[model samples]
Target: MKRMLSLVVTTAALLLALPASAQFAKPEDAIKYRKSALTVMGTHWARLAGMAQGRIPYDAKAAADNAAVLEVAHKLPWAAFGADTQSGDTKAKSEIWKEPAKFKEAEERLFAEVPKIVAAARSGKQDDLKAAFAAGGGVCKNCHDNFRQ
Candidate 1:
């Protein structure tokens, strides 16, 4: 009984030490993770865009908070695009796996532009924030047109 207890404790510790990606037992889990991350990123991006486009009254603090959320959320979904995740309930196109270089380039473009948007939001200039937000949206559109369903 003592030997069994020791083995169980060791297994639990090993599992806990695994990387987050390594903990996914099914491709569906990765798909779900990426989808959830994209949803959150979209929510934040929409809020920022509303302010930039004048649809929503611009609050400097709210803009900054939303942009900060975008900065972090944009970095999350990419890691979940592991092998076999493409077969699940993801809108990610097969081009992501077939033309990985192109897909990565598109992803990199958004990552690069998001920081500029964040900076603009923190700059307290509405014009700069609007321009940056539009640019970031363009990057997102390009990637979606190419890589997403």
Candidate 2:
């Protein structure tokens, strides 16, 4: 039994370490990757919020796990907008490039909010998580709606 348990633990660790995708090799690639990650992350995050809010059923653990995904996903959006990063399938608006300062300011706002969402999600505090998730998620949507293609 102990040997079997050890094997299971080893397998789980290996699976967790699997790389999700190719690393960005250039600035443009990085931007493209970040945009993609943001969208995918946003989709999952929205579903997570729904679950947390009981727009779907409440699943505390699931919500917490989804929050973990956001922790990384949340970091990519702004990084993708760097001068070297551009030309992608994203809905990212030219305004991001046109007004670097303002665009970065918006990104800053998002960065500021994401940790709070992660915290609330981790806390398993339903209401707090929901509120933070809404705000953090909103930042993403707002940016996508305006700047992303």
Candidate 3:
């Protein structure tokens, strides 16, 4: 029993050490990963939007932190939307696969806008940050309107 336990622990450790791309053995795992990343991104984006909309008081540091998180988080979910992941507990629309070019364009728009938000937030200008935040949110909304249910 002890030898079996040791082998199991060794196997788990080896799996944990693998690269993230190599870690998903199933499409469901990838879907779950993407969903989790999007959830985190949404949480951070909401915080930034609250400040941008004046629903919450602006703190330069907090805005900067949230923008930084969005910069990273925005890049995470795409890889998980693999071909095998089409049928899942996701709000992702079928058009993402059917209309790949359009989807890619939307993704490109988001990638382009997120950095501007980060730069504006880091600049400590609330007005600029607010504008950037709206632009970024619009990018997200555009993608959601087209791709998400």
Candidate 4:
């Protein structure tokens, strides 16, 4: 688990270091990169969600750790959604490219919510974490429902 977390953190750091114009050599590479990033985000999210929904024992330390990982992982996937990546081994819908502005707005909305979850987790309040998690997950569902297949 530590190894996987380290790998996710390393990958997130590398992706975040790239310039805005960074382009994958092939569309498949972009798809793979985004999918990997999203997988990492989802893994962390599930852990937090489980705690929030009472399915798992809520440990303040664990919640904070997962939220911190999520803070980085959440930002990693958006950069890989290049125009050329619309068609590939991805669940991304065509609307993502065709309606870039709307997609970006949705992305921005998600970005806006992540910090709240981070703050709530760091506060060591399970109720706060639950509220923030619900809000953030709603934003995620909006994006997934509209932009993913």
How much does each candidate deviate from the true structure in C-alpha RMSD?
5.9, 7.4, 6.3, 6.6
Compared with the true structure, the alpha-carbon lDDT of candidate 4 equals 0.87
Q: Encode model 1's per-residue lDDT on 15-60: one tens digit a residue.
A: 8676656878888898888889999999998888888899989899
User: Which is better, 2 or 4, measured by lDDT?
Assistant: 4
Candidate 4 per-residue lDDT, tens place, 84-146, comes to: 777867889999988999999998998898888888888998999899877776888889899
Give all TM-scores, in the order shown: 0.83, 0.69, 0.82, 0.84
Query: What is candidate 4's TM-score against the reference?
Result: 0.84
**Tens-digit per-residue lDDT, 27-90, candidate 3:** 8898899999999988988888888888989999999899889889989888777667788788
List candidate 3 segments past 4 Å from native: 1-23
**Lowest lDDT 10-mer window, candidate 3?**
15-24
What tens digits encode model 2's per-residue C-alpha lDDT throughout 4-52?
Answer: 9999999888765644232345666766677688777887678677866
Q: Deviation in angstroms for 50 in model 2?
A: 0.8
Best candidate according to lDDT: 4
List residue ranges in candidate 1 displaced over 4 A: 1-21
lDDT, candidates in the order shown: 0.86, 0.71, 0.85, 0.87
Total clashing pairs in model 2: 5
Q: Tell me the deviation in Å of residue 18 in model 2.
A: 24
